[model samples]
Target: MKAFVFPGQGSQFVGMGKDLYETSPLAKELFDKADAILGFKITEIMFAGTDEQLKETKVTQPAVFLHSVISALCMGEAFEPSMVAGHSLGEFSALVASGALSFEDGLRLVAARANAMQKACEANPGTMAAIIGLSDEHVEEICKEVSVGGKVVIPANYNCPGQLVISGDVEAVDAACEKLKEAGAKRALPLKVGGAFHSPLMQPAQEELQEAIEKTGFNTPKCPVYQNVDAKPHTDPTEIKQNLIAQLTSSVRWTASVQHMIADGADDFTECGPGKALQGMIGRIDRNVALHGIA
Candidate 1:
């Protein structure tokens, strides 16, 4: 079976999706629609903007989503997937690709999510760090140990074997990194991010985005979407919505999600997004599967 995946925030770059926009009429139309719907010339920013401009949360989220979903859509008959999954913001892309959400609705939701997350970051400052060459249990235990007295940190993204990302308050995250390094982790590198995503600090963003999500309609997707919250495949609309609502504050179980897809007979994996991060993670997760990229 074929499993199509989408990448998250850090996958974006300058001139992303410009090639498709110029080469495919459908992609151009969609890009135009995105610009109008976003109330800005997002296409110009995506096509010719500088790195700093594209790094804005609002632009990065939507730009990556557009590149990912449009790439899959432009594939026409070749974009078939028995199952799909995405990392963080890319979940919206996967939802749109699998027919669970309309293109316009997906874009609107991504915009809303980006704004909400940005506000949450401003309201409560925090950050994330990457812990490499450590067991997940060791990192989790260290996070739990350091998180105390209103300082919250947790294992956020389980990227692949021996690699995990943790998110939380700045002080708590710093303390956790110290402990993780002392616990024999090969490297504990802090990520350059505005806030702690997929952690308790995003509770405000979760609450705010929930209203928008509940109000939006979701159709049953063409294929099951392995969600990030629990790394489980969901096909029901209500369940999918609920998972999405919870996703902002839950861990992104990417490693488990890929494992489940392979266990379920997904030997072919295609990453539909701007960067090759997901492909690299999937390759580390299991080297036997064939991997491809569309970006």
Candidate 2:
């Protein structure tokens, strides 16, 4: 069986989806529709915008979604997946690809999520850091015990073996990094993200997104989508909504998600996005696994 994956933020770059739009009429049509739906020329930004412009959360989320989804679109009959999973923002892309959400609705939700997260970041002013060569339990324990000024830090993304990302207030994150390094972690590096995503700092964003998600409708997907919150597959709409709502404050279980897919007979994996980050992570997680990239 084939499993298709989508990448999250930090995988985007300048001229991401330009090639497909310029070469395929189908891709062009989709790009035009995205522009109309987004109320701006997002394609221009994605195709020609500088790195600085694409780094904006609002632009970054939607641009990466468009690239992954459109790349899947251009694949036509060749795009087949027994299971699908995405990292963070890429979950929206996987939902659309699997038919759980319509293209326009998915894009709208992604935009709303990005804007809400950006606002929450501005309001909280927190950050995230990458901790390597530390057990997840040790890292989490350190973050929980190393609070400063009553601020909280927590493990955020489990990217791969020996790699975990922590998110929280800037001071708490910095303090936690020092502790992690002292705890024998190989490296404790701060990420360039604007805020402490997947942490309590995003509570406001989660609350705002709840309304948007509740108002939107979801359909049964063509295939099962391994969600980010739990890294499990669910077909029920209500359950999907609940998981999505909880995802904002939950660590992205990418490593576990890939393991589940492998155990469930994911013989081949394909990453559809701007970068090969997913492929690399999946490779590290299971070297025997076959992997491919879609644009």
Candidate 3:
């Protein structure tokens, strides 16, 4: 079976969709539609804007979504997947690609999500860190230990074996990194992110995004979508929506999601996005699977 995956934020670049916009009519039309939908020329920022401008949460989220979804859609008949999954913000892209959500609705939801998250960041300041060469259990234990009193810290992304990202208040995350390094982690490095995502700090964002998710219409996708919240495949719109609601405050089980996909017979994994981040993570998760990318 084939599994098509989408990447999240941090995969974007200054000239992300330039080639697509210049080469494919469908892509050009979608880019124009996105510009109108967003009420700003996102294509300009995506194609030639400065990195600082592209780094804005609002722009980065939608930019990555457009690139990923358009990359998959432009493939036409060749884009087929028995199952699909995406990382963090890429979930919206996956939904649009798999036919669960209309392109316009998906873009709207992504924009709303990005805005909400940005607000939550300003309201509750926090950060994230990458813990390398540590077991999931170790990272979780260390985070729990650091999250004392009213402080909050937790494992945010189970990207692959021996690599996990933790998110929480800046002080708590810094303390956790100190302990994780002492626990034999090869490296405990802070990420250059605007806020702590996939942690309790995002609860505010979750509430704000829930309203948008609830109001949006979701159709039954042609294939099952393995969600980030639980690493489980879901086809029901109601179930998918609920999972999406919780995704902001839940860890992205990328390692487990890939494992489940392979266990369910997905041997061919094709990534449709701007970068090969998902492919690299999947490769580290399981080296036996055939991995490739569309972008």
Sort all candidates by lDDT, best to worst.
1, 3, 2
Where's the lowest-lDDT run of ten residues in candidate 2? 141-150
Provide the TM-score for each candidate, comma-separated.
0.99, 0.98, 0.99
Q: Which candidate gets the maximum lDDT versus the true structure?
A: 1
lDDT for each residue of candidate 2 in 124-192, tens digit (9 for 90 to 100): 999999998988889989987987567999899998999999999888998999988889999999998
Which runs of model 3 end up more than 4 angstroms from their true locations?
none
* Cα lDDT computed for each candidate against the true fold: 0.96, 0.92, 0.95
Clashes of 3: 0
lDDT of 3 by residue, 1-295 (tens): 9999999999999999899999999999999999999999999999999999999999999999999999999999999899999999988999999999999999999999999999999999999999999999989888888888899999999999999999999999999999999999999999999999999999999999999999999999999999999899999999999999999999999999999999999999999988999999999998999999987
Measured with C-alpha atoms, the lDDT of residue 95 in candidate 1 is 99
| Model 1 lDDT per residue over 95-212, tens place | 9999999999999999999999999999999999999999999998989899999999999999999999999999999999998989999999999999999999999999999999
RMSD of 3: 0.5
